[model samples]
Target: MSRASARNVLLVEDDTAIATVIIAALEDEGFKIEHCTSVAARDGWLRGHAFDVMLTDVMLEDGDGLASLDSVRKAAPDMPVIVLSAQNTLDTAVRASDSDAFEYFPKPFDLDELVQAVQQACGGSGSSANLPDEPDDDGMPLVGRSQAMQSVYRMITRVLRNDLTVLVTGESGTGKELVAEAIHQLGSRRSGPFVAVNTAAIPADLIESELFGHEKGAFTGAVAQAIGKFEQANGGTLFLDEIGDMPAEAQTRLLRALQSGRIRRVGGRQEIAVDVRIVAATNRDLVPMISAGTFREDLYYRLNVVPIELPPLRDRREDIDVLCQHFLSQAVEEGLPRRQLSADALEKLRGRNWRGNVRELRNVVYRLALMARDDVIDPGSLADIIGDEQLPIGQSGDVRTSGIGQALETWLAAENPSAGSVYSQAIAAFEKPLIEHALGRTSGNQLRAAKLLGINRNTLRKRIGELGIEPDRFARPL
Candidate 1:
């Protein structure tokens, strides 16, 4: 705490209200504060004095704060800079990261965290040496300013400078692939080729050949020599989609490749060294798969060096309106009839539980753009399009008519799962979601969730780990 007594902070923020809050917080922490309202005043202060760290906003009265950090850095090359901006987007985050700022905080950030970040910057707990700030024309792909997305943006920026393998997990249609794309496009590997392969889409028999660049004449169908994903992504990135679906044999090989940074083609004895950064994504619950012995625990740890858990769309319903508009614009650009969504229509859209996440919303918007009768769509038309998404339950909402019954019937018809194992399989399937529902309502608190589920806390905790359920995702951010 005494470290900040002699440390100095030069804050460049134009908003009086925001400046007051930051100044008050830093002063309470025993730091010497020099506040400026514009980039001009900021540079002047930098020229006249020396400060341990600088905090600047993106937009200033006279010029761009981030764009102008170069001059400030030239004046004080060693001074770490933290950027604050209301423009919350992946683009802004990448720019802030590319500028080599100590930290980038989207607006509505926690004041306490801000103070702590300044403390760390001044204390040199993290390296914050200044570097040139550059701008990219087309890095603003992902949308939504909700806190959920903000958390994602921050995590993305943190890994831009390194080649740590990232495991992106979320439900289907939650834009898991988009996270992979963002990291590949904005990170240090931006210039390298990005190769993506869906393990689930490829045949299990050929999964290894597809990934390791199957040796020619290695297998019956392998008549010609073929290069694998590793060779294709040499010196760049390989995005392994649906990694949980990879066969067990392939999992072992993948683990070896990740560990050794070398791959051996199928039927070939020679080991070829390749430099490739891995970014794997999956919508399936990998922990459960690992527990079920379908997925490799060692391989999971290797790919999960940096875990980025993407929030489902339902969790960020506040962004529904913006997402609708974004999709509508895309629809327009694609030559669909331009349509406007009314407040009531958006209200109706937001009301539904978006079980399909962002992908579902985009599809519905695109459909509305093409099919709506009027230019401005209302709630009536919206409901008609969305139409009774719920199951055909009885008046009392009987369990038979609900989705679980239908799924049970389908499973009985399909897998048959063996008469001896049917009960266990059904329990395995239904019990996971039942526990998930409890943890969800209790915000991932094991003790509280256990009480609600009428089970012992330790039992519920044990079941959670055994089922590979991640309780932290259900826990709301503080």
Candidate 2:
């Protein structure tokens, strides 16, 4: 029979409503639609007759849609299988593509486009060659298969369903703010604004004004009535980053805001009722700070209502390959040439102690894309960009020497003669360049730079003073 005259399609969908809608749409296009809700029925129907194309949901009551795809491909190798799923992510997209599926449609997709994709898979004149590409608007979501990240995803989904306060704790480069943004996106308040404030980045005197806003005459620089993050994020999410670095006064006021759901301007007495979900993040161990009396224990409990901990990248090395591919795809979407990592380069990445975690990996990949001359990224190219001295011992043949201890010893012997004073200078030298490098990377955005360096902005400021590095030097020119 001719191709157009014999277009038979099998659609496996668990939702009866969705199946009815899709079947009506496909049937209208002059193709026969055979519907099945379970894999057993789908297999039975496949055995009875040949199908030109197959459409299956990723999840069903009996089995996964990919399994159905496998069965169809085995029985009819030429038949095209399209996967429909609500769980839209890079990892899922890649999996579908690698499985030789013809296309993928994320949920809430346009019916017209899906029909067209089906047509194309069946070799129709107006059919698309591949599934509609995943949207490239946002940068890639955090991709991982490791248990650590899986747990993190689960906790984020659970916390996003409510307005309870959240505290995200992790090492500096572990993408704490990304977790907060994910929570906001997945929550009921997705349409609401997501306002973020870095407590440590603001000056101690100005923190109050920054968090609670200020009246026109609040202070010398307060020329107009300013709105704070709390007010701006009203009815949404307010992410307080580096909460541990907040000044005692600011901490007290923040506690009041969390407790009362209200705020008063710096120079105004009226307490304005506000509704905002609070998500706080910190690299510091709050338990220690609470014991030391620097952090309020009550505030800790309030913010820790739903605690989410992000494991450092080193702890989840299994995710490095997936993350690398995800980032490479991101770079390509951003107008850079697409590239793949060589096996050696990928192995090196897996072996490294990722102190900076995901953030550092992103930077490394971006740098490699810019510096690599060829389409494939080799180990040498990656090493050159991330610096060879930072490579793991087994790969580089160099003894592991990049640590605070080694830095301290070098500084003590070279710069300080008196043992008593050596400790201070050693600490300064070890910290100064790291802060400077992070500042340079972020163009002196103290908040982001502080997160990258794994130090509180207040501590960064103190070190800036001790190192005699002017903050203005690192500031970007407007």
Candidate 3:
């Protein structure tokens, strides 16, 4: 039969509701499915049946569904299998990846995406994942079960079996390094070294040498032949933290290395071939930098092959309690006194801006574990620890601004729109709004608006024209 008629699917799911939903959706898509709730029945059905694809769950009534996949693979080795699981952890995602599942869908997934995936999977076995030995350690490097994190987990699983350049972008302290560790430690290169270099921390002068080692006599401080991060991370991942801060010259060498899969030591004759996966991360917005010519656009494309953007803790406040608990356990392991988290304290935590994100939360949790007077931590204890620092930006609290000085400070730090046009850019950004406000208050009367704004009427008119502001819209009859 042609690929279009390849709609025979076997679903091994235990949940009645989930099975009903999947069966209905698949049947509606014109797929003929054989549904079973247990691995025993699945195996019995597989004994005489042929299927184009299989969809199974991790946990079943009798035995582990993933373990039973060996028989299915042997029976129909070419058949693609998709695994669904409510055990929504990175480990399960990795395990499903290890079992050669075409796709791993976490519980409460979108039905439309599932149907789309089923339609695509029926066509061919085009998955790039290879069966590698599953990681032995069950440690959870990352936390949170929110839908945002599930998207992260799925993306991580997709890259475990291959060497794909990954770019992780997020605000500071959003666990970019943890994502890097998860990718390396759970992947086929787990045995290889995981080398991380913060490009932002390194001086512009030394970044090139830091990344691609220099010869013993290459520079003034070249007392010995140094191994660069590229050599150190051979056969594993090279995590370039704050890639946006890489100097122009270093960006050139880095792009060449990525292009050639090799690098030449500074002042060295021979180039060395290195087997390494590139995982770059940046807290800064690189697109703006690229436009400003501060960051290389070509390098951005090279590193952004598989982009995974992490949400800030403020966006995922529902995860605050679990993250706090996780950090509390970690604090105790580090010899801090153990403490129970009170519901009121957790509720209090849900309010703050969490400007520092997970790293900030972890710090607060550790401090609470250390400074709490009582065994059960409460809001009183939290207040004592974070006293006078809470900005009242949390749930049901007022979001107070830090004034224009603070706004300018934040803008300068984030944008650095200087580039010899700082004044012009600043004026271009703020002048339009200020003029619009004055016009609004004066009903677009140019003379009164100019007088209110303390500027000449002609100047106001010229600016209004330059800013493309139509004061007539805000005007009223004299």
Candidate 4:
């Protein structure tokens, strides 16, 4: 370890206690510490001296420390800046990343993490450039509270300020486009347009011309010069969805563009420089594609610089209730009648296999809002809406498609709750959907349901009252 006198650390923190603790910790680790209470003092110190690293708190007594990031970059481009802030939301994290912070610590952070970051910085020569100032925070559309989702959020936040290519992998309808849009909207390139191209959706022959543009008379149908997605997305983000399907010729050109930061129009000689960020998404496994000679392994490495793997909806079932509510609100905004899901209805939704992930869930919510007879959606209405969407089972013969037993097993595994009420809970789960389904089919006529269910009408009414089943909702319209 170097002597404390040989290395200097500039710390800008308004809180006296935090500053003292941080200063003491760095000094013990053989680092010389220079403390500033506000951005004003930091600016004054920036003129005459340089430091090994900088530790800054976003909020300060005089002005925000984050706003002074440009000054630090200007004064010493190679000095790494670690941000500390009490504002621990995603917005703050993204902003810290946008400013090209070496590391960011929320207030009440682990001191050991900070120490390790500083030690790493001290041993290395920092060369990454400062990121341009980013736009105001635009909330991301990603909806989930599971640990899996949290990891995705962290990765997104880390890449917001950089031009690094990101490869998002997940099943279809897992909102890969949503992830791409969020990164573009929240990053320095928000002022630029976001262009998206689905590689799989386009024909094989036209993929290159579609992405790299074409000059007049380039091909048989080239009557005029046309801008490609690469040129159109210059200074912004280009989302290449389903990249695993990109043709070999286009993949070769894409690799060239990525390497040279330039694109050449079809049938034209000039190399046009473009300042675009690429975000690619695919459901197919690229490793297998590479092995099969479908996807280029070299190109895959270039695009997979930062990989964000989104967990399927089934893996994050804890988010289903919130997602349903979010979709319900979106429906109301779009002139649909307001609708709320009953507890049992939400439970039913949580229990299903979301083969289509968030997209399928949104469709079900919209259908329930449109077709359900009442404002409060019950388990029966949801079941009916979702049942209509059951996709044909594939070769895997997934057990989730078999019945509600799969859903209950998943819920039971997650809960591992007391076994005493397991029988009752299981019975209620089956009974509510069945009884309400019968009531809906019979136009809410108890006698008809009793006959259909092979039970006494009095007994049917008793079960209806016990389950809080609103039979009126299932009555046929006049």
| Candidate 4 per-residue lDDT over residues 287-358, each given as its tens digit | 988999989999999999999998999998988988998899999999989999999988878887775689
In candidate 4, what residue range of length 10 has the lowest lDDT sum? 388-397
Q: What lDDT score belongs to each candidate, Candidate 1 first?
A: 0.82, 0.76, 0.83, 0.81
Q: How accurate is candidate 2 locally (lDDT)?
A: 0.76
Q: Largest TM-score belongs to which candidate?
A: 1
What pairs collide in candidate 4? none
Worst 10 residues of 3 by lDDT: 392-401
lDDT score, candidate 4, position 325: 89
Model 4 residue runs over 4 Å out of place are 1-89, 95-134, 388-478
The superposed Cα distance between candidate 1 and the true structure at residue 477, in angstroms, equals 28
Better of 1 and 2 by TM-score: 1
How does each model score on TM-score?
0.80, 0.60, 0.79, 0.62
Ranking by TM-score: 1, 3, 4, 2
Summed backbone clashes in each candidate are 1, 1, 2, 0
Model 2 segments beyond 4 Å from truth? 1-140, 391-478
User: C-alpha displacement of 248 in model 1, angstroms?
Assistant: 1.3
